[model samples]
Target: MDVNFSKQGDWTIIAVEGRMDTVSAPEFEKMVQERILQGSNRLIVDFSKLDYISSAGLRSILVAGKNSKAKGGELACCGLQGVVKKVFDVSGFHKLLPIFDSKEDVLNRE
Candidate 1:
């Protein structure tokens, strides 16, 4: 998987591409952790190009979300589709995580 990071205002936007499996999940987690340690609390995960995600990926996301929330910020995801959306829905993550239909929706929200 490929992870690209950018910043918009107080948000650290992470754009993920390809598959997020066991091997890649740790890398993803590491990147997020680094950002958090750098004092980046508000996060937006853009899964617009993500094709697949395993349970490990979900775990990583959960950890990142928790860390952000614990720091008095928030984490949100956008642009979910197909199998990825199905996984999230089936796993009940859609309810637990803040999900938006588009990046614009996330960016515009309070």
Candidate 2:
């Protein structure tokens, strides 16, 4: 997947394209860690272009989310559709993670 990152105030927004599977999970994890290291606590992941995600991808995000929470920060996701949404649904990650219908929704809420 191709990942693009931007910032808004204290929040870091990431746009991910393509598939986030075993091959790309580590790369994404590295990006996330870099953002955290930059002192960005609030995170919003845009999955509008993401086509697929595997267990490894899910695990990496879960770990990142936990770290963000432990740091008293927040991590939100938006724009997931089709198979990507289904993956999170089946894994019960829809409930575990804070997901939004759109980027505006996440930005406006909390």
Candidate 3:
């Protein structure tokens, strides 16, 4: 998987592409952890280009969410589609995390 970082107002946007599986999940989690440690607590994960995500990937996201919450900030996701969306829905993560149809929706809502 490939991860790109950007910024929008106070939010840090993480755009992930390719597949987020066992091999890439730790890297992704580390990246998020680094950002959080750098004081970027308001995070938006963009999964529009993501094609697949394994349970490890989901665990990474859950970690990020918990970390963000612990810091008194928030973590959200957007642009979910295909299998990624299905995984989130099936795993009950759709309700666990704040997910939006797009980044704009997340920005506007929060």
Candidate 4:
């Protein structure tokens, strides 16, 4: 998986590409933790280019979400589609976290 960071207003955008599986989940988790610890509380995880996600990937999202909440900020997700969206819906993550159809959708809501 490849992760890229950017900013939009008060939100930190994390754009992930490729597959987020056990092998790559840890790296993704670490990146998120570092960002949160560095004071990036408002987060948007963009999964548009991600083709697959395993349970480990889900765990990373859970951790990031919790960490953000603990810091009095929120974590949202965007660009969920195909298997990734299915996994999230089946795992009940669709209800646990805020999800947008696209990055522009999230931004428009703000």
Candidate 5:
């Protein structure tokens, strides 16, 4: 998996590509941890190009979301589809996390 970082206002956007499996989940978690340590609280994870995600990936996302909430910020995900979306829904993460249809939707949220 490949992860890219960008910013808009106070929000840090993470665009992920490829498969987020056990091998890449740890890297993803580390990147988010580093960003949080650098004082980034608001986070948007873009999964438009993500083809697959394992349970480990979900766990990493859970950690990031919890971290964001603990800091009084927010973490949202966008562009989930197909198997990835199904996994999230079946795992009940759709209720646990804020999900949007697009990055613009997340940015525009109040």
Candidate 6:
């Protein structure tokens, strides 16, 4: 998997692409960790280009979400569809985090 990062105001947007499995989970985790260490609070994880995600990916997301929330910030997942959305649904993330239909919806809410 590959992660492309950008910023808009106080929010850090991470556009993730490829399969987020066991092998790529660490990379994703590292990117998130770096952002957190840099004192970034608002995190918008854009999954529009993501094709697949395993449980390991979920773990990374869980950690990131927890950290972001603990720091008095917010973390949201945007642009999910197909089986990728199914995984999140089955995994109960739809209930855990603020999952938005699009980037516009996410930005508008903020």
lDDT winner among the candidates? 3
After superposing candidate 2 on the true structure, give the runs of residues whose Cα lies further than 4 Å from its correct spot: none
Clashing pairs in 1: none
Query: Of the pair 5 and 6, which is ahead by lDDT?
Result: 5
Each prediction's RMSD over C-alphas, in Å, is: 0.7, 0.9, 0.7, 0.7, 0.7, 0.9
lDDT of 1: 0.93
Residue-level lDDT tens digits of model 4 in 1-110:
88999999989999999999999999999999999999999999999999999999999999999999999999999999999999999999999999998888877895
lDDT of 3 at 26: 99
Better of 3 and 4 by lDDT: 3
| Superposed model 1: Cα runs more than 4 Å off | none
Question: Deviation in angstroms for 77 in model 6?
Answer: 0.5
lDDT of each: 0.93, 0.89, 0.96, 0.95, 0.94, 0.90
Residue-level lDDT of model 2, residues 1-110, one tens digit each, is: 89999987778898999989999999899889878877887899899999999999898889889878878897899998999999999999999989999988988886
Residue 77's lDDT in candidate 1 = 94
Give the winner by lDDT: 1 or 3.
Answer: 3
Q: What residue pairs clash in candidate 6, if any at all?
A: none
- Candidates in order, TM-scores: namely 0.97, 0.95, 0.98, 0.97, 0.97, 0.96
lDDT of 3 by residue, 9-102 (tens): 9999999999999999999999999999999999999999999999999999999999999999999999999999999999999999989999
lDDT, candidate 3, at 97: 95
TM-score of 4: 0.97
The superposed Cα distance between candidate 2 and the true structure at residue 17, in angstroms, equals 0.3
User: How high a TM-score does candidate 5 get?
Assistant: 0.97
Candidate 5 Cα errors over 4 Å, as ranges: none
**Per-residue C-alpha lDDT of model 6 across residues 1-110, encoded as one tens digit per residue:** 98998988888998999899999998889889889888997999999999999999999999999988888998999989888899999999999999988767877884
Candidate 4 Cα deviation (angstroms), residue 87: 0.5
